[model samples]
Target: MTILDLPAAEAIRFAVPASRWDDAYAAGMSEAELLLYRSNLLGSDLTVTNFGGGNTSAKIMETDPLTGEAVPVLWVKGSGGDIGSMKLDGFATLYQDKLLGLEGHYAGDQDDDKMVGFLPHCTFNLNGRAASIDTPLHSLLPHRHIDHVHPDAIIALAASSNGEAVTREIWGDEIGWLPWKRPGFTLGIMIRDFARANPQAKGAMLAGHGIICWADTAKDCYEQTVRLISQAAEYLNTRLAGQPAFGGAAISPLTGRAAIASSLMPRLRGLMPNADNASRRKVGHFADDAETLEFVCSHDFSRLAALGTSCPDHFLRTKIAPLVLDPARLDDDTYLAQSLEDYRALYAAYYQRCKRANSPAMRDANPVVVLVPGVGRFTFAGDKATARIAGEFYLNAINVMRGAEAIGDYVALDEQEAFDIEYWLLEEAKLQRMPAPRPMVGRIALVTGGAGGIGAATAARMLREGACVMLADRDAAAVEEVRAGFARQFGKDVVRAVACDVTDEAQVSEAFAACSREFGGLDMLVANAGIASSAPIEQTTLELWNRNYDVLAQGYFLTAKHAWPLLKAMKEQGGTSVVFIGSKNAVAAAAGASAYASAKAAANHLARCLALEGAPEGIRVNVVNPDAVIRGSRIWDGDWRRERAASNGIDPGEELEAHYRNRSLLKRDVLPEDIAEAAYWLASDASAKSTGNMINVDAGNVQAFTR
Candidate 1:
């Protein structure tokens, strides 16, 4: 048999001996817990499984705590649970007999949605954890352990035109193959009948979907899955011998990289009209990585680009086909706009042609992944992780298709079959499992002092929760690095960066201008840029006070003054917010730090006055007073760390953080995320009515209390 080589697989085998599975069976941990453990092993590897790509289950007996009666239950992955970090509660426990009984009644009508809706009611757990749509299929399977995954290697064969012939060539009768079908009531019935027909087979492959492997033990089933996929990988490696990546498809961008970043990314964000002059859903973020670049730049791009996705799960994630940008028109905004319009029209037509009664409205017509010839494949999503999932999946898919093309023609389910799965209620239900977006979603935020500490953390946090962010800092390289990294992860529209000396009025104006140009306007302004450690009065020079006050005092003033118009305009949608990153020093002066203390104190008063002026314009101003947030903070970077360490009688590197950790009444180490969470809540609607206040985030600093 082939060997398991995935990193997650290796880690599991190392941590749990081969006998661990047997030990678990004897230990009396519920089957749900066992499945949860194994599911995490598989879900940890993106190469084998993505965010919600695969599921696991086992049938077992659980004794009722009250009656002491043994009962049969089917434990399946819940609808919205991530396999990697899933717990016992993440699995839905259903009465085995009731779950299996549903198969007999399903006539396959609008019942698809009804069946999913009724799953929670059937769940044995009273907490309302919903079962996945594939619960019935898992219940009907006779095997003790079952796993279903959309592995990249398996997808190459399953999606290929010659998959059946190739699958048989590789495994012969070891694995049975099924025609492309949306997973539901009828599909569950097929799995049952298929298993009965081939009692000796190891598992089954779901064409245009994924693979399933089953065995008496979780370890045995997992091993079999690895062996089967490894065999496929070996076959693929042989076929890829002579072909070069990006061989036939590569062409230069019509313009240069600088031009693309400066002009192309923004133009793509514009409102492009359809043939009827109606604009569709605006695209969100753009994502690209090294692998995505290779595929889009390959010479064989056209032939591969025309093919559909390797599996149907991606029809929900990436859609059927990514809109390929015209290579020659990369520099022309008008041509790009016209092309996007055409792309929307084509998608609308595709939906109309195949949509059945009760079909969900066609997903926004804009493409998720856009391939620019010279630039790379750009994945647009509502968030970074989704964008990465689509980009990563497609990049892997290209290799799978290359393998298939080497052996035979790469094929996918027909348009009708793909449409059926895309519109299926079971597939649509998965989205409901996602955590509700934060209140700041669809809003724009500009954060100053974003290079490190609270500023960087807040920018990332806001972007993750669904707000577009613009990061401003005088550290040019740091700002760009954060900007570029976040842009790649969250899409270009999701994050922007400007190297602005916040104390400079011109740079502040330019920062706001850039913010408006990218995201239209801003709803939240976090004036967090400041430096520390001014000399005491006796030793202080004119320069020390000016430098300290310029950043802590004037920086806050300039950012607020320049951002007011945009903040006021935010009233059309909702009230805007200004969160100043003040310090505990504002309320309590530290001796030998007159300039620093006085500067922050001035900034603190500025916030209160700004609140009075901004209240009339619906611009709520607030401040977060925090002390000593060390990690990822430049504030503790240089001479100050060594001096503080010496004063504490500890090593500079080892105990610098510990020295301050004890100063708080709570004795907790304040980190950047703590400050960020405070800023996030203030910027969100949670503090909509309560503004013009200062929140002390110092973990109980009574020295500055009651100020």
Candidate 2:
């Protein structure tokens, strides 16, 4: 027995409330309330509809309160509204007759854009929301309630090469099949006409698009949707039931997964940004979910993934075929570099080939999905959320194609049809609403000592400026705590924490590697991990000296050593940056602090050397020297508070803060933010030409200023 052998009642989780059915309109509720309740219920099952993919609607008549005349309204899901979370506002109430009347004046050749322009005039106080493109299609249909969904199972048949034949075989005259059409005014009219021609049909599969089901009530339409989807699933299961699960020789791990991921991430990320400029940046997010890996490891992954999307709307979301990576070439940076370049070139060519005179100017021709043979999939976008969302859609597309391949041939619309949706005015409108890109919009950064006050604050600042951050610290629990807080502010995936002691070579390596694997690259390295120790030359012990130098000086060396390869690769595209957090003690020695001051002095010198070496490769290295910052500082927490107060001959709390605040030329606390701001300049293109320099952020530390 296979998935199809399951009992009908057990297959799908039909979540429509029983109370909703009992409270039906004529039975006791208004059409709007029933439709809304039903829409919410339908959206609750993601198997039927994924986020922002489908719509639900109903035709209702409500009496005009003032005129005492019945008004017909088509309550359809609006643009940018997820059916799963649909509310009354999510549905745009449009005058049904007004929408249907557009076709009389709208030329048969008019695309979705021209028809969409007329929607605002027809909407009935839609609260500033425009109806979805599917709104006109729903209103044109004679059914009282309609549901248009992208069901993986149904599309397996609908998006197949033999879709029309399969539809006729399964549903007979019960449903009509309309081959792919550019959806908008033209497609809507075509669907309505097909329904009229096949008056006995219950619903229709809009080939290479999705399925539409209709009935007099929302419940009937929903139930028909479930029943039709189930039939398709069962049909597909039977064809695929006897096939053995995919198996092949295990893929050899490329070098160390850590090191390869560490190096590969930056190389790929470096290429994502425009090579001609420092600012045209985009980020990559790596995901190796079970499904993604399973499919990519299968025998047919190359062919199936290279094929276009199973539906038309997916063109707008995933672009054309994903940029494919040869599994055997995963370890080669040179090979990966050329492949990504080819990927971009192909996309630009595809756009040029299909673009119309009126089409919007092409955005960057970057692949939304990058398939890495046995390694799995990496999704790219300007931000983490978009990448993850596109990943979900790509995963689903893979599954749908798998089913279609088993049943027949997995087929999508032609290039022109895909271009139609990809450049559709309605779809472009959504991308246009995105906020202006920030300086580090597509960059990724790694911050060490992130559990500490300055380190955590720097990470927060980087996240605000639009860089995905990896927070590495020796304190596992503290780093996790800081990570959770950053997650609340930035998205959960936007910030991650790794328990890595920078002083330990192995831990430092693993931590940086994880950053690459998770974020797909690294652009900025903020080496701020350090500890201070105070002792006279006579009292300084071997143990104390080693600990201070190991953390303060050796740690910076280790991080730079492990990070240089990635940064060098990044230089092939735009500029990359590195900053080592130094201390005022490095330049102005304090009594009984030979070990602390000397180590920081060495670290600062290392930054200067790195700047000299990395300059040819477009990597900038700098130092941010900060003086005493006591209040709310983890470095000054616990026993350090007593030590600091004793050294200053003052009380531990207010007095300690006042001592540092008064020491500054600005007569204010030399804050971690002040230092972070200095680092930000070095990280951004704003300091593109400034490298090998010490940026003093000590408020008024005249002693540490260049002399």
> Which is the leading candidate under TM-score?
2
| TM-score of model number 1 | 0.68
The collision pairs in model 2 are: 665-700
Which RMSD values do the candidates have, in order? 10.0, 5.2
lDDT of each: 0.73, 0.77
Off by over 4 Å in 1: 1-30, 64-67, 107-122, 125-127, 245-249, 252-263, 270-288, 327-331, 427-436, 442-446, 451-527, 531-707
Candidate with maximal lDDT: 2
Give per-residue CA lDDT, model 2, range 1-707, as digits (tens): 00112111111111222222344343655788777777776676766766677788898886655577888888888887887777787788878888878876776664457778788888775457777777777988988999888877777777788778888988999988987776677777788888989889998898877888899986788778777877777776666664522232124223344455455666777767553234655566676666666566555666677777868656566887898876557668788778878988887888899998989987776677887755667777777777777887887787677667765788866888787778876677877886677767778899999988789889888999888899999999999999998889877968899999988999988887888777777789999988876666898899999988999999999999888876787786667899999999988878878888999999999999999999998999999998886654777876557766787789988888888888888898877787888888888888889899898887878788788
Give per-residue lDDT, candidate 2, residue 149.
85
